[model samples]
Target: MNLKTFLRGIHLREEKELAEKSAIRRVLPEGEMVYPLSQHIGAPAKPVVAPGDRVLMGQQIAEPDGMISAGICSSVSGTVKKIEPRMTVMGETRDAIVIENDGQYTPAEGFGAKRDYKSLSPDEIRTIIRDAGIVGMGGAGFPTAVKLTPKNPESIDTVIINGAECEPYLTSDHRLMLERPDELIEGLRVMLRLFPKAKGVIGIENNKPDAIKLLSEKLSGDPQISVQPLKTKYPQGGERMLIHAVTGRDIHSKMLPADAGCIVQNVATAIAVYQAVCCSTPLITRVMTVSGDGVNTPCNLEVYVGVSHQKVLEAAGGLNCEPEKLISGGPMMGTALYTLDVPVQKTSASILAFAHDPVAANPSTPCIHCGRCVSVCPVHLVPQMMQVAADFDDFERFEKLHGMECIECGCCTAACPAHRTLTQSFKYGKASVNRLRREAKAAAAKD
Candidate 1:
């Protein structure tokens, strides 16, 4: 089938064979799960249960403060071990609720026995989703309900579901599409009805022909629905990148997809929305891919939130060789794990370990004044110039070059023949600028 190709993306070696052929299994680890209060993007959840208190599975342990926040719940029947600071995906320690599993699996009262979503109004649908604690499962962890209620309704005409698992070694989304295609379509239909004016599109890369074929066949009769197969490329799954690929529109620096008359969601988030709205299931468990050359057995697994990285690695048959580096998500955008004790959260797509010398093969050398970084940048920014400014600690020059606009997709770094750490330098530069802004605000407050 002819696919609707997108502009400007690189194709890295997809080591999906490690987990692509395998199915998602369950990680039945019994112990204390370090459930962080701030799993979503907004304000951190305020705990309702104390250390001595007991909680059943699916019980709302924390309530939402605002519309942009999702509620928090216990994933297992356990006693509150403690509520203390713990390491998170963003690599900072924060307040977390620890629960000790009792092995009973006692679910909270009236967990799934709720009214059907069809009976509810559009506002009611949003309330149900917010109440169930559903967020963007695609790693951004933004509140789902907020996305549904567009601030500027006049701008949006499309709601795109990102099925493009462009990052290598991540097959959780793919497995989800194969296992839960019907549920996905049902969720999409619900979304289309919610956004009456906007058309619904499911964007999948050509690499996953089976998913495209299956989903397209399912959505055939629906006039408002169409399946667009994107060319297999890196960063195609990004909101801005995917939007550009599917709609030929570029989201501005200070705006969201909704600003461009579009709101994109991950395929996993859509299925979760279906379960939350239709099936009345809370966001407790998420599918994750455990793969890399370091692992002996690689496969996708449904892991309860707060389960440690150590447990997941063990489930993947432990490491074959001592890994050079361990990442919380995929290699490209995933954070380097400082400790394996960091529990898996909603945004986690994969746990990657590199045993072989992938980085050692090409060590960083001096930039050869090549224009490759500028040419390959998907957002059309001069990454090389920004890197130079950052290296010299010239904050003025760095900020002037639209350094903050850089998505840090690593395309510039990946394409550099000199193997320069352009992404890392840019990240530091951005952080420094943010810090300066914060300090300025503090000084203004004092004045």
Candidate 2:
């Protein structure tokens, strides 16, 4: 098989062996579950259920506030204990719905029935997905229904299913591919139906040969879909990177996948789409990998969205030792957690606990003028220069250098021999640039 890959991504110690072999196990929370309303990138969902209201599993507890937002559903059947601000995985407090579990997983009315998807129109499919509160399960948390209804739907000619699972120690998508290939393929078909001229492609990292082979064999008879094995590299699962690897299309900084005539969906998101359309199921539970040196037994667990991190760790047999640090996703790009009381949101892919700090204890030093950061930047940006601009508060130079193009993948920081926090600096600079833009817009409006 020909191995395809994007340009300039670093290869790190995969460390996937910790949980890659473990099959996804279902773990139910024994305590209250907290569902944050602002799980996705858009406006927070508006709460429809108040304190004392009973909600069944898959019931809509919150509705989308705008076209950019996604609805929020109850993952377990129970009475709403409270609708108040709660801590989330991102280390911030947000409005969340707390449900006291009744121990009975009762399905909501109009759920649990399979429908003939072929009979449904594209609009109907989009509506079902929107109502189900589905988003990009791959961690971006972009509303899936909004992505399917692009302005120029006719221009989309291909749909790419990302099975790269490139983030180290995260095996949730890999396990899904190996265990539920048929459902994933069905989901891909459902996505293709939204764009009449589109064909489907599944891009898997060459590292997961079993998934590639299984999906290829399962999709053999289908003419509309094919599988391609991508080179194993960090951030290869990124939308633009995967798009380039599969279709050889370059999406400029301000452009989207649709601009290149493609729509990329994560492998797990595909399964969620299938469930939403076929089984009348809403986005509730998701498969998440909990692993690292600090874990007693690292494994992939099918976790409900609102479960607490502490509950998840306990279910994984509790921590084996004192954790030096806890991260929400992969080490490279995942957010560090300040507390274990935070609830898992829709985009929580993995919860990593390390006994020792993964980074070297050495202090960050001055840039050695090495071009390593430039060499490994997948987006072709000069990290050293970007960091310099950010340091001096040179917003003009930063904007001119396309600092916003940085995907925050941490490749530059990893490649920096001097241990500069290039990615972190870029993140700060991007925020500053964005604030300036918003100020300018506001001034223009005032005039």
**Candidate 1 segments exceeding 4 Å error:** none
Q: Each prediction's Cα RMSD?
A: 1.5, 1.0
lDDT by residue for model 1 over 1-447, one digit each (tens)?
Answer: 666655566779988888887887988868878888888899887888899898998888878776567788788898998989999877888899899988887989887775566777888888878877888988789989888888866567898999999898999999999989998888887777677788889999988989998988888888888899988888889888888878888885788888888989898899888888888778888999998888889999998887898998898899899888888887888888867888888788889888865667789999898888887788888988999898898888998999988888888888899999999999999999999999999999999
lDDT of 1 at 332: 80
* Model 2 lDDT per residue over 241-269, tens place: 99999999999778989999999999889
Using all chains and alpha carbons, the TM-scores for the candidates as numbered come to: 0.96, 0.98
* Cα TM-score of candidate 1: 0.96
Model 1 residue 4 CA deviation (Å) reads 3.0
- lDDT, candidate 1, residue 303? 89
Model 1 scores a C-alpha lDDT of 0.85
Which pairs of residues collide in candidate 1? 155-261, 156-261
Rate residue 23 of model 2 by lDDT: 95
